[model samples]
Every structure is written in C-alpha cells, then in structure tokens.
Target: MSDTPELPWPVPDERFRHWAGQFADMHHLVRDLVIPLGLPQAAESVLTTARELIRMSYFRYEFMMIGAGTSIIAIEAALADRYGKGNLAGYLKKAHADGHLTKEQYDLLDSFGRPIRNKYAHGDLTHVALTPPLAIGMLRTAITLLAELHATPSPGPSAGGN
Candidate 1:
C-alpha cells in the first residue's frame, strides 16, 4: 500500500481557509460572469483554455528564467515532468541525436530559460506583461501538438478487429 497521508477532504490545506473561501467566491463570480456571455462549444472552449494555459505558462517560464539568472536546470526538470517523459525535446533528441537542436535555436532557448527560471523559483508575479506575439506562437505550437497527438493511432485495435 502507499504511504500517502489520508485527509478529511480530498484537497488538504488547513492554513488557507479564508483564501480558499475567497477563491471559491471568485470562481463563482467568474462562472456567473461568463455564463451570460454565451460561450462557444465545450470542445472549443477546452482548446481555447489549453492554448491560454500554454501561453501563460511560457510567459511565466520566461519571467522566471530572467529574474533568477540561474536554476535553469531545475526549471527544465520541472517542465520535463509537466511535458511528460516523451516531450518534444526528448523525442526530437532521440530522433536525431547529434542533430536534435540547431546551434542558434538551442542558444536562444538557453537564453530564454535563465530569467524564466528565476520568476518560477521566487514566486514573483510583478513582471507579467502578455506579449501578443509570444502568445500567438505558444498557442499555435500547443494546437499543433494537440492535433498531432489526436491524429496518432492508439495502441488498441478497433472493437471488431483481431
């Protein structure tokens, strides 16, 4: 059996009761606000939300990289966890080995990671200005990856197939 602690409720956070109450209120407010706006289809809403998440996360990544000026390795390790073991970087590296990353692109990503790691490490939200271009790029990349993953065949055969 696992050694994880059993809690009274699923989410255990005793110290933040007030904050949690405020959060729940805000969540209800947002839901009420958006419900009247007549949103798109559920699938489209999910895609839109996912795109925003990727963009925001990348911006957060950048801010952290810039502020810390170190801890890039740890940040990348955490990203590897989120992106899964078979992430783009790992897959590309495995595909080409020596040719995985071009010198210029690798250097650019390395440069970007430095400060982003800092923001993530320090938990500071002071430097959050959304760049349209970055958001577009990240969103497009996310959509493409999601599409490709959806397109790929799963392991199991069709219901009637041998």
Candidate 2:
C-alpha cells in the first residue's frame, strides 16, 4: 500500500462541478489537439507563462486600484482640514510633490502603474498588456503608497498658533 494518506474528496456545488468538468475536458482536448502542432518546448513554456502572467496582471490591477482608492480616502480624511476640490490624480500628485512619497516610488506609479490601471478600468485591455515584471513593480509601488498614506499625520492647527 502507498504510504500517502487518502484525502477526502471535495464536494463542490453541482453547477461548479459541472463547469469544472467541462473546463477540464476542453483543456485536455485542446492539449491533445495542439500536441501535434510540434511547438518547441521553450515556446510552449513561454506561452504558458504568458497566459499566467496575463491572468495575474488582471488580478493585481484590481487589487492595486482598490489599494490606491483606499489610500486616497485615507489621505483625504487626514488632510480634511486643508482639503481642496480636486480629482484623485491631482491629490496623489500633490501628495507626492509634498514629500509624502519617495521620488522613485512616485515616478514608478505615475509613469507605469496609473496608466495601466486606467486602461484596464476603462475596458481598453487591447491597448495595454502587462508583463509579470511590470505587474510586480506596480504592486510594490502601490503597497508603498498605501503604507505612506496610512502613516501620514492628520492635519491640525498651525504650529505658530495662527
């Protein structure tokens, strides 16, 4: 007998199970059909990685947007005393220019992250494709931005007692 312990079968909902079965069947059929195409192993590996990166990019974009939105809300709340009527991008730029974000961090977000996120949000996926490195960089910048926004001190009365 095998040394590995038997795991209990997961009981999924009927609809989910049905869909999963269909997906698996289709995947196997596609694989079988494509095997005869004689694609190089390296090319297949790259294709697989590209597919995963595309899926991961979409996931990261959604969370990055959420994180950025939450960070904006925090910044707005903290600076409510001095808040002005403006767009989110304006506030973000003001925050960066005012020394809230490091120069490198701001540059990364402004130059790459924001435009990609906007494209995805506006359903313009055809115009922008995200690579794994780019997605990772954007996520890192977003995390840093959120942390900085969260750690910011709330605005208060002038120090000179104005």
Residue-by-residue lDDT tens digits, candidate 2, 61-120: 333233332333333343343346665466557768777767776676667656654665
TM-score of 1: 0.31
Candidate 2 Cα errors over 4 Å, as ranges: 1-84, 156-162
Which residue ranges in model 1 land beyond 4 Å of their true spot? Answer: 1-46, 50-122, 128-130, 154-162
Shift in Å, residue 135, candidate 1: 1.2
Residue lDDT tens for model 1, 1-162: 779976553342333343234334323322321211232244235445533333233223343223222223322443343344644345334323433334543443344433443454576534644242333333333233333333443333345776
Global lDDT scores for all candidate models: 0.35, 0.44
Per-structure clash totals for the candidates: 13, 0
Candidate 2 clashes between residue pairs 3 or more apart in a chain or in different chains = none
| Candidate 2 TM-score versus the reference | 0.44
